[model samples]
Target chain A: MTLKVYADRMSQPSRAVIIFCKLNGIDFEEVRVDLSKRQHLTPEFREINPMKKLPAIVDGRFKLFESHAILIYLACVFPGVADHWYPADLFKRAKIHSVLDWHHSNLRRGAATYVFNSALAPALGMPLNPEVAAEGEKLLSASLAKIESVWLKGKGRFLLGSLQPSIADLSLVCEIMQLEVVDEKDRERILGPHQRVLKWIDDTKNATQPYFDEVHSILSKVKEKLKKLQAERGVSANESIGRTTLHSKM
Target chain B: MTLKVYADRMSQPSRAVIIFCKLNGIDFEEVRVDLSKRQHLTPEFREINPMKKLPAIVDGRFKLFESHAILIYLACVFPGVADHWYPADLFKRAKIHSVLDWHHSNLRRGAATYVFNSALAPALGMPLNPEVAAEGEKLLSASLAKIESVWLKGKGRFLLGSLQPSIADLSLVCEIMQLEVVDEKDRERILGPHQRVLKWIDDTKNATQPYFDEVHSILSKVKEKLKKLQAERGVSANESIGRTTLHSKM
Candidate 1:
């Protein structure tokens, strides 16, 4: 039986899972669970994942959730895929696992909250909570700094210096990519200091190819909409009024 | 060179790693970093883990942080260890991974935050924010409910129906063990509803043996102190005054 992946591309981890399946040419069915519409919270979806999370998978009688776990499972089950993605070497795999585990409270929290406050909240017609936005920005900056100084500090193009990208690379880079949907100035402010991290993001994008772009199309559209709103407002991208106008539009 | 694990008994994940090492009989050195004294923040220790989190390890030249990652690395590197702790079976391992990953945001968050606000913050002489404490209780209760209804609903003594406890069981059980440090009334309210979760905790403790008790000795002391305080106050264990008296002692 073919693997079934339940995902919503808007979520960073979901995108990572979808991109992984697509990149490896794994035979799978992509089932979209729309988060914006709150589809994941429904009883039916809850049955698949009682946690009611996305990026879950079902292969015959077996079912799994948590994107990193799903990725590891795929890596182990699909022998056709290269080992570099989730290396078999004990030390190397452990290092990758370290990055994956750390990503949750650090990068994922920072990036996710930042994008939600700076971009998503406003777009969804909710007033931005200044305290949350400020906190989010602080977290985002710290996460970016860590990525620059720590994870991406190594000589390799990817995290952990692997020639090929691992699941950690996909998971983290997708998280950072959400910054694109934020206002240009906010994005630059949060992501600007990390030159190496920026390079790593580009490298990951290039390596993942067309599927990367495909999975990220919604974010690109969001970015474009924000840009057009700014243009219509006749205000600079960094100006507070531009954001206000965008908020009004929503 | 022997593996060097930097940990603190007070921290849940640190206890998880220490217990895993002791339980598996891995020859390693335990380097305690006293978190209450802010020892982990020292520049020297930060060299070992730039993230500055406890439960880091230095295995010769390869350094790793994050307890779950360390456990996986240990399971893989130590060939003689029993496989059920981190099974080689594809589906079984993935389910374990699923539990490990789900733990951080759910069980770990709820239990850690609940203990921090209700017990640690006050013990550290910090004022308790009632709002945060209430929120923590809600989260803790919800997390426990999920554990009983979802993770522990299976027939086996451990998660995933394994006859033997996996690292997920240790990681989660250690997290829940934090509740013991909380006030008696609050602890019962939060933990009382979930019989299965309670059973699983006992099962996990029994399975791991002396190491589980050794790692959790500090918590035991805290619990004993609270019980004594309750007795001295001439208040029932469920009474609010008992906690206030305990707070004064701390």
Candidate 2:
């Protein structure tokens, strides 16, 4: 049976999983479970993942969730995929795992939550929560600093100083991509201090090629809709803090 | 050189790493970095883990951090350690990886944050934030529901229905142990509904044997201190929502 990936492009990790399969040339069916439509909450999707989460997969009779696991599975299961993605060397693999684990609580938290509160929530009719946005931005900036100081400080362009892009590189880069949906000023403020991070993001994109850009096109579309909503609410000019001008647009 | 472990027992993941080392008989030196004293923030500790988090390990020249990474590394690098802790099979390892990844955003977030805001903060003289505590409890409760419905539903005793405990089981069980420091009524309210989760916690503790109980003895002592703080602040009876009566007792 063909592998099936249930995902929504809007979710960062979901996009990472889809991009990975495309890059590896893994023959899989792309089943979109739209989060905006609440499609993933249905019973059928629950069969794919008992936890009812997105970016789960079904391969033959087996089922799995969590994007990191799916990526690792694809890297290991498919003979065609290269080792640099998840190297066999014991120490190297452990280092990559370190980066992946760090991404969840650090980059993923700051980027995903900040983007949701700053841009997506408003477009989706949830009132702007400046408090959460500010906190998320603090974490987002600190995460970027860690990336610059520890992971990116080495000679190699990718994380852990790996010459090739590993799953950690892809996962973290996709997480940072969520910043693209936020306002340009906000994005610059959060990411501007880390030159190494800016270059590393570019490196990850170039290594993954067409698939990385192909997957991120959805985020761009979301950005446009967010801009229109901001303008309609007069948010861009005056930057009102207390108003709940949010509407159900997306 | 013996494997050197720098950790503080009060930290859940720190204790997890230390116990795993003891249970497996991995030859290691225990160097305590007390979080209570802000020892992890010292420049010397920074050399071990740039992130300044507890439970970093050094073997000869190599250094690593992030408890999940350290656990996986210990499981793979050690020759005599059993395979069930981190199976060689790709699918099984991936499923365990799934549980570990899920633990971060779900169980770890809920247990750690809730325990800190509700109990640890006040004991350490930081004001209690009921708003954040309430949210943490909700997430913690939902996380427990997921544990029961998905991972523990199978016939096997542990998470992912594995007959033996995996690193994921060890990590998450340690996280839930933090609830031991909370108010008795609060603990029952959050965890009482899920008998499977309760049983799984006990099963994990039992499987690990004397090492589990040995490491958690520190928590029992801390629980005593936490209870005293609650009593001193009249937090046990009136349940004041906005009080900084919090003293630096720990």
Candidate 3:
């Protein structure tokens, strides 16, 4: 049986997993567990991951959840995958682990929370929270700075100076991709100061190619869809959310 | 030169790293960087860890941060350490990764945020935010439920059904240890429902004895100090916090 990747494109980690499978030509089925529809909360889905989160995988009888775990598992189990994605050297692998762990608490938190409050909440008809957005933006900038000054200055195009993109590069870049849902100006303002981060994203994109773009096309559509929705709903909904996404994006 | 560990025992991750080294009998120097005095923010500390976080390690020329990464690095590098801490097997290690990654965003976030907003804030002389604390409580409960229903249900004494404790065990158990700072009643109120989780913490503590209690002695003193401070400051100090940490803890 083919490896089963249960995901929804809307989730940042889910997209990362889907793109990774495609990039490596790993034989897998994309089983959509849509978060918006509450599909992941169902009992059927719970059997795969008791946590009830997306981006889970099942290889034969063995099952796994959490994107970083899934990614690492794939890297190790799949013989066809390149060594650079998750090297055999202990130190190199540990460094990647550091980046991934930090990304979870720092990058993912800041990017996702900020995007959800600033953009997606209103578009999805949920209450907008400027307070959370502000806090997330502060964290977001700090994480970007860390990426630029500390992680991405490596000799290689990837994080920790690796010549090839590791799972860390893929995980973090996908997190930044969530910013695409925000208006063009906010996206620029948030990511602008970190030139290294921007270039590294581009480099990672180039490295993975067609799959990266193909996987992220869903996000671009969601952005356009959200802007059109906010434009239709008009002022009242966007008022609670400062920096309304509609006028700026449209 | 001995491996140098820069840490403050008050920080959860820092204590985990310290305890792990002692438990394994790895030679190291404990270089304290106190968080309360903002010592971690100093330029000298930044040289050790660019993120300015606790529990960084400098092994001769190699400097590393993020406790999970440091744990993995240590397990792989140190020959004296046992295999179960971070086994050589690909599958066993990947499962451990899942727990550690989940612990970061879910367990660590909920535990630390709740402890800070609910109990630690007023004790340390910061303003209370009941709204954030309530949200943290909800996340904390959900995380504990996951721990009970999912991770700890394994056949063995540790998570993932491992007969021996892994780094995942150390990292998470240390995170749960932060709850000690909260008033005893609230700790029971929050952790009471999750029987398996409580037992697992005990099991993990047993797996890494002496060092666990030795490292946590600082937290015990802090708990006492906070109680005395709150009592001395009087009721008005605890008024804003709805739960009122004084009566139950004392």
Candidate 4:
């Protein structure tokens, strides 16, 4: 039986997993767990992952959740995967683990929170909380600055100066990709200063190619849906939420 | 040269790393990074770990941070360390990774947030935000319930049905142990419901022995300091901050 991956492309981690499998030419079943419809919360899905979160996998009798875990497992169990993705050397692998662990509370949190409040909230009919959005922007900038100075400091193109893109690069660049849904001005202001980060994103994209674009295409549709919603409402929802003031404060 | 661990026992991750090294008998130098005194934020420490978090390590020329990464590195690098702690088996190690990744946003977040708000806030002369504390409690309860029913479902004494405790077990159990500094009644109310969790905690302590007790002793000092502060202040700080009404609502 092929490895089974339960995911929705809308989630950053899910997209990373999907792109990873495709990039590595790994055969797997993609099981969609729609978050917007709350399909992941169903009883049947709960049996597969009691956490009831997306990006889970069932490999034979083994069950696993958490996207980073799934990525590491796939890389380890599948002999065909390149070593650079998750190096066999203990020291290099440890560095990747450090980056992934830090990503949880740092880059992932800041990027996800900012995008959710800035774009997805109104699309989901939830009011944007400007105070939280302001906080998110601050965190987002800090996270981006760290990436520019620290993670990309090495001579190579991706994180930790790797010749090939690692899971950390895939996960983080996917997070930064979410900014496409935000207002153009706000997104630029948040992401503009980090030249290295922008270049690294492009580098990661070129490395992953068709799979990267394929996994991320859902976000483009999301952007279009958000645009249509604003057009139909006869106003930019961001303006209605006083996003200018929020951006200024940030 | 011996491994050097820069840590402060007050931080949960620091304690986890300290206990891990001691439990496995890895020789190390303990370099204190006093977070309370803002030592981690200094220019010198920043050179070592730009993230400036507690529990960084210097192993020869290679420096790394993030306790989970440090734990995995130590297990992999040091010979004669038992396999059960970080199994070489691909499936079991993946499950352990799943638990550790899930831990950051769930068990660790819930436990750390609740303890900081309820106990550390007053210790640091910061007022308690009861609303946030209530939310923390809800998350804490949900996390504990998941640990009991899902992670500890197997007959083994530790997470993922392991006969021996893994780093995931150490990190999470240490997070829960922070509740000792909270109000006795509140701590019991939050932790008492999960019998398996309690048993697992005891099992982990037994497995790690004197090192677990030694590393955790700082929390006892912290409990005493809190007691002294409450007596000197002549009122419950929680009452001053309206924690009771918030608890009633919750």
Place model 1 in a CAPRI quality band.
medium
Residue-level lDDT of model 1, residues B76-145, one tens digit each, is 8976779988988888899988989988877787777667766677445575566777777787788788
Candidate number that wins on TM-score, 1 or 3? 3
The segments of candidate 2 whose C-alpha lies over 4 angstroms from its true place after superposition are: A235-250, B234-250
Per-candidate iRMSD: 0.6, 0.8, 0.9, 0.4
Instruction: Write one digit per residue (lDDT tens) for candidate 3, span A121-214.
Output: 8655697799999999999999999898998785778899888899999999999999999989999998888888999999999999899999
Please give me the DockQ of candidate 3 compared with the native complex: 0.76
Candidate 1 residue-wise lDDT, A1-110, digit = tens: 88999998888899999999999989999888988788999999997899988889999888899999999999888868888899888888999999999888888877
Model 1 chain A poorest 10 in a row by lDDT: A229-238
Cα misplacement distance, residue A173 of candidate 1 (Å) = 0.4
Query: Which run of 10 residues does model 3 chain A get worst, by summed lDDT?
Result: A237-246
Q: What fraction of the native interface does candidate 4 get right in terms of contacts?
A: 0.95
lDDT of 3 at A26: 97
After superposition, the stretches of candidate 1 with alpha carbons farther than 4 Å from their true spots are A122-127, A224-250, B222-250
Show the lowest summed lDDT stretch of 10 residues, model 4 chain B.
B232-241
Taking the candidates in order, what DockQ does each have?
Answer: 0.74, 0.79, 0.76, 0.82
Where does candidate 2 chain A have its weakest 10-residue lDDT segment? A241-250
- Candidate 4 local lDDT, residue A223: 93
Question: Which prediction has more favorable DockQ, 2 or 3?
Answer: 2
